[model samples]
Structures are given as structure tokens and as C-alpha cells.
Target chain A: MARLTLDALRTILVACAGEDDGVDLSGDILDTTFEDLGYDSLALMESAARIEREFGIALDDDDVNEALTPRLLLDLVNGSEVRAA
Target chain B: MSTQSSTAAGASGRRVVVTGLGVTAPGGIGTEHYWKALLTGENGISELSRFDASRYPSRLAGQIDDFEASDHLPGRLLPQTDVSTRYALVAADWALADAGVGPDAGFEDYDLGVVTSTAQGGFDFTHREFHKLWSQGPEYVSVYESFAWFYAVNTGQISIRNTMRGPSAALVGEQAGGLDAIGHACRTVRRGTRLVLTGGVDSALDPWGYASQLAGGLVSTVADPERAYLPFDAEASGHVPGEGGAVLIVEDADSARERGVERIYGEIAGYAATFDPAPGSGRPPALGRAAELALAQAGLTPADVSVVFADGAGAPDLDRAEAEAIGRLFGPHGVPVTAPKALTGRLCAGGGPTDLVAALLALRDQVIPATGRTARVPDAYRLDLVTGQPREAALSTALVLARGRHGFNSAIVLTTHRP
Candidate 1:
């Protein structure tokens, strides 16, 4: 599997929010909390699950709780994939 | 009729009254919408749109084409539950609002409880998981699948979400469990619980749900919409499948009075349950005995019952059996009978609670709703089956009868709240 890209993670978060189909989120989505984007726990969970499935990585319970924003989640996903490789 | 046997249990126990009603039925969304649709005698059954049933024997169902779960539920709840659970949650929202309560209505400190019944829970969710297991692998399956299909999920979720800490349970009597749930609620209230939420919700519209139902061979295979599910009619072949639920706020009458609840629908004056004869036992079904016991517990005679909500099982023998049961209790053609289920097909366990909601509405409005789409009653039934339009009457008392597909029989007696 290819490494997780910032653009790809942005697309997943935007889709999980149901804000738009393919809006460009290459800016500061990494710093914005899910609640700041009007995304609920359900949306965040969906994003986490999709990230795991798409990147072929497992997120532990603590990692999921710690990854409250896009940047944190991307780091976790990258770390898991590195460990797997 | 022995008065002692009839009034003994009722006189000693705390009286239970229906304070609020909520529904997500095929015909409409809320209680008012449902009642109006029933009054117009409209048929809600249509060709199944959930999937292609063209090759299946039963092609029609009481499908809710316009249910948008997001409209009634929060996003957090959507990921963990199925459509049936969504229906129960939505219905609970309506029932609580109708009863003038809120999520934080101060009942958290009181002994409020919830009791729900369903033969099968969330088959639609289960079907999706099975497809995943077969196509992708078990590893791709979801953990939510465990509680979503469990029959008790409704009660568990309702109690948890609403902060109800009293006695809560789920009953599994298939069709009859809907009415039985209310009976159980009443018993819970009589045992000192202040209030209880009771009802049932089920949907067999998907492949797994429909396949299990098809195996029973009891669904209507009629191609024409009008001819399908003609309960109590000579041409009655079988029932059409349906998906929906109803929830009622069953409360101690005194507690409701103290809470200033002005709109009491009716009191659960009596209820009874009985088993059908073992196959080939040469004895008639025990539905009539159940009816007799319910009426007796209500301290009422057949003459006191203003209307009879027929089960309308939609098979010839089953219809005749229910008719005979009514006949034995009320004498031949003794009471005005109607089966509003012809309007929305059989909702499995949901049907009985839906019928109870209709009966309560009838008592409140003083009009007996018609049995939609059923034109003629077979002579063998000897019932004054209401049809065509809503019948205006003094519907002060009603008996709702239900028999599970699995042979559980139950009857509940409701009377206008006198005190």
C-alpha cells in the first residue's frame, strides 16, 4: 500500500464530515479538531475506520483517542504502517 | 361471569393508563398521521422497493419509503444501531414529547423503565454483515452486529439513552409480544414502578428477513395490490410483510395525575395470555380463553366492549380461528370488529402495539377506524367487520387481540379513564 498522503487524509475527513464531495482541504484541517469542523464522534469514528482500511494500518485504542485532529491521525497512521513494514 | 374473579386483581393493583403514544408505521410517521391514514382507509402496502423481490413469492410489503433516520436521530446513534432501533428511538422521542417529558425531564431519579418486544431485531443490519462475511471475510465484519440484531437492544438503548433505571426487559413472542409488552409494563407499574415505556418494532423486508418469512409460507403472493392480504375475507390467502413499531407511555394512574397529565388515552384495565392447542389436540385455539380472561379481569362483559380489534392473521384457517375465538367470547356477530392491519400489512410484533395505539385513538376520538382494503367478511367469521370509511361510535372500551406466528396468544382490555 502507498504511504498515507496529506491530500488523501484531507479528502477522507471532508467526506466523513459530509461537507462536500471533493473540496480541497490541503490547508489547516490538520490543526482543526473534529468538533471545530462540526463533525461529531460518529464522523470521527468513520474517518478513523476509513483511514485504517485505506492505509492498511491498525489504530490502537489509545492512538485513536489521542488522534483528535487530522495531523495527529496522519502521524498515527504513518507510524502504524512503518511498524508493519 | 364471576365478578369476583373479574375484579379481584384489578381492584388491588395500581391502575395503569396510557399517557402518550408514538409510532413509525408504514402509513405515516407520527400518531396523528397514522390515525388519519387509518381513518381514510388507505392502503400503505406497495411493491417492495428495498430490493428486487420480482423473483420471490411474496413481492409486496408495508414499506416506509420516506424514513430518513438522520431526520429523527442524532449522528452518534446512527453508527451503532439499525433501522429498527432507529424506529424505536424515534418513537420514544415522540412518546416522551407527547407525554410532556424530556430527556432530562427529572424522571432520572424516579423508577421509570422500558420494555420492548421483537421477534427479530435488525435483520437488515444482519443481512449486510452476512454479505460482508461471505464476500470479504469474517475479519471485515463489524462489532456493532452483535447488539444490533439482539431482540433486547431496543430496551437496552432506550433505558441507557433516557437514563431510565427501573425494571427494563425485552420480550420475544413474535406477533403477540407487542401486546404482551404492555401487559408486562402494567405489571411493572403495579409492582411500584412509576412509569414504563413498552412496545415492539420489527422489519423483515430484506433478503434474510424475507427469506425467513418466506420459509413460513404465510405471506401473500398475490400480484394485484388490492387482492393482497385480505384478512377475514373469503379470498384471504396470506398476510403481506410490514416493518414498523409503536411505543406507549404506560404510567401509574396516580402518578400521571400527580404529574398533571391531562390527556389520558385509556387504562389497561385487564390483560390475559394463553397458549394455542398442541397441533391436532382437537381443542380450539386459546385466543378465546385469553379474551375471556382479559374481559373478566377488566370486570367487563362482552356487552361492555365497544369494539374488537381483530388480529386478522390473513390466512383462512387462522382468520376463522380468531373469528371463532371472538364468537365464543362475544357470541355470534356480537361486537363491531375491525382489522386496521389490512391498511399496513402485518408488522409482526409491531402490529399489536400499533393496534393498541389505534384503539386508544379510537377511544379518544370516539370513532372506530375502518379496516382498510378489506371489503367483505366471510360468512364463517360472523363478524361485523368495519370497512369503507371510519365508523363513528361511542368507543369507550376496546379489546386488542394478538397471536404470534409461533402460537403465543394475548389480549388486552382498554377502557376510557374513568377517574
Candidate 2:
């Protein structure tokens, strides 16, 4: 079981954004879409891909696509499927 | 002005000449293969093999297969550097050799320059590091990871490895960084330098990088491999993403002549880069501006040119716009046009140099290879697209264009040894 902590989120955030200083990391990861968080679609995809490769688990598109908040992405990371609206 | 006068031509500069050529692209890992593949139109675009891209929106990409990194990097350094740096180092070695300036090339004290352009610098490493951090604790995050994938790292890596002390800079342009690298190198040489190793390489093969590109809507994710990267063709759905590398040995005319270098590949005759003043039609035929400026800088006219190396970005809006620009500037029939990149996929910052290599070789061999796989041109695109096999023609002057993914546009004019 992996610990879904802020530090872990920060690293992923920095990598996706292609830099470290933009997002409101001290608060939430899922509070925004890639665009709102200054993360483009490319950066988000990169972040998701690396997460999959690192965790050695097959993350489905819904798992990545549905997670919008930092808490939500972390929740999604742990295998909790996003609740469809 | 109808005249294609690049800023360099108007600046009153010393004649710039190319002394060496090197490449590590989809065409081939090295210059020879890079050129040969383009002539034969080998398709670099294919289904995603680097990662399991089954679920992604687009499965197609231009990936460089069989790139055995160990072949390029010695034992110790392989683990530390990113793939981007590895590609750049290998390309620089090839360019220096092609220029006839090896470790024993005799000028230890001479001032040399090195400039490389890149869009996504080290996505692979950054992606991996992020994964590690997620999988392990903060301690597991390699401290060096901070600098490993940054935008400016590759240029520094090449400069340090080559011991190049003169004029070293990197352009953080979108895709145009590749051709812009050449323009920068040309200007650096004109300002004075013995030789410059310049070009660009980009690898978005990693899943993270791939996703990033896919999300942008820039990549042609079509499942069918053949239809993935048809630039200038009506069937051109979208561009295939991939890696590309090219290195040029730029030098002054007098210096090259002094070394007794044989007939020059082509001179860095003119270069012009302009930003889109506004997004509308007034976006200024910025690319055309780049071309005209380049031609004018070379002291040549469109009538003097035999062929053109297009950007061929493949996005419909950009594609039609580019075609209209070319037909408007060069008049459809007169100047033969070709873009062998359809097979190699667009290399982003690396695309320009890859296209320039084809253009430079065309000047040397006088054959313009056709655009591969582009079976049909859009109705709006009226230019005579070089289709299927190569076009046999004597080329004395050539034009190469590159545009930043965001907005910057550049044009470089090449000419045979100007007597």
C-alpha cells in the first residue's frame, strides 16, 4: 500500500507542470483541471503515465480522467473509483 | 515587400557557410541513414510501442526504435543523464566528425560554439522521478532530479561535454526551437566562430510525455499507421508525435576555404524569425516573412530558388495556412516543394534541422524527395506537393521554414558555395 501524501503529490505536480512553483500545492491537487492548475494536457498525461509505470498497476482512463482534485487523484490512485455524477 | 529578405541579409553580415552535417532522426540514427531514409520515404510514424497506449485517444506516434543508448554513452554516465542529453551528445560527435574536426583537428585554442534547440527537454526522467516520489518517500527522490529534466539542461550538457567555450545558448521555443537553433548558430558564426555544432532532439516516447502531447490535440492518434502522418495531404488527420535530432557544423566562408573543405554542403545564407503580431489573418504571413527575409538576406530572389523544405506541421488550420502562404509567396508551379518528414513524423525542435538536412542534401545532389504518404492535397492547398518518388532537379538555392508550436516562425535560406 502506498502513502498518498502531499510530498508525493508535489513531486507529481512539479513533473506534470514541467516546473515546481505554480500550483497551490499547500492546499489541494484536485481543485483544478490541468488548465486551471497551470498544467496542460501534455503535462497531466505525463504525470499519469509515470504514476502508472511507477506503481506497476494498470490505471484505466476513467481513473485518470475522473480525478480532478488533489485528494481525488490520490483517492483514485489507491483504487477507489471516482463516483460518477 | 515581395522580396524574401531575412533579418540577417539586411543586417550586413559576413557570409555564413556550412562545413559539416550530422543527424540522429526518424530517417535514421545517423546522418547517412537520416538522409537515405528520407529519400526512400521511410515512415517513422507507427503504433505506440514504447508504452501500452491502447486506451489513449491517439495510438500513433513517430518513435525512434532500436535506439540503444549504451552505444552512445559510455558505462558510467548512462545512469545519470536523461535520454535527451544522450541523443544530443551522439549527434554532436557526428557533426564534429563530418566537419573534419575530430579530437585531433588541431585547434585547441580556437573559439568554437555550440547551440541546441529543444521543446520538451527531459520528460522521461522527470516522469520517472515523479513516479519514484509517488512510490517511495521524499528521500527516494533523487536530488539531482530537479536539474535532470529542466528545459535548459540539454544545451548545458552538450556544451560541457564538447568543451565549447564560445556562444552557447538554448532557445526554449515550442517546436520551432529546432530551426531557430540553426538560425541562432548561423548568426553566431556570422558574428565569428570557427565552427558551431547546432540542431535539436526531442523524445516524448515515455507514457507521461506521450499523454501530455496527446492531450494537447497536436498528435495524430489515428490507429491506422499509414494515415497517421500525412502532411499536406487531404487525409492528413493530425501529426504523429516522435523524436528527432540533427547537427550542423556552421562556419565562416573564409575559414572553411582555409581548411580546404571540399564543395560546401550549403551556406547559411539568410535567416528571419517573426512573431504573429495578432492571431487573425493579420497574424502576418510570419512564416512567409521568415522565408522572404531569409531569401533576401542571402541576396537571392524566389526566382533564384529551386526547392523549399516546409514545416509540414500537419494540423489542418496550420497546414492550409502554410500552403496558402507558400503558393502566395513562391507562386505554385515554379519552386519545387518537398517534405520527407511525413515518414519521420514531426520532431518538434528537431524537425527543422531534419528537414534542413534533406534540403542541404538536395542542394548537393539536386534531387527533391517527395512528401511520403500524402496521397491527396486539400482543395485549398494549391501548391504542387512532391508526391511519391523523388523529383530530379538541379537545386542551387533552397529555403527551410520552422514555426514554434505556440507562435514564433523562422526561415533560413541555403545556397551552394557562393563564389
The TM-score that candidate 1 achieves is: 0.89
State the lDDT of candidate 2 residue by residue for B377-399, as single tens digits.
Answer: 87668777788888898888888
Task: Specify the highest-DockQ model's number.
Answer: 1
- The C-alpha stretches of model 1 lying farther than 4 A from their native spots are A1-51, A58-76, A81-85, B1-12
Tell me, by TM-score, which candidate is best: 1
The weakest ten consecutive residues by lDDT in model 2 chain B span: B1-10
- What is the iRMSD in Å for candidate 1? 5.9
Q: For each candidate, C-alpha RMSD in Å?
A: 3.8, 12.5
Q: Candidate 1, clashing residue pairs?
A: none
- Candidate 2's displacement at residue B80, Å, is 2.2
How would you encode candidate 1's per-residue C-alpha lDDT over B229-338 as one tens digit per residue? 88898889899889997999999898899888989999998889998878888877889898888888888888899999989999999999888888888888888999
DockQ of 1: 0.15
| Candidate 2 off by > 4 Å | A1-85, B1-13, B280-285
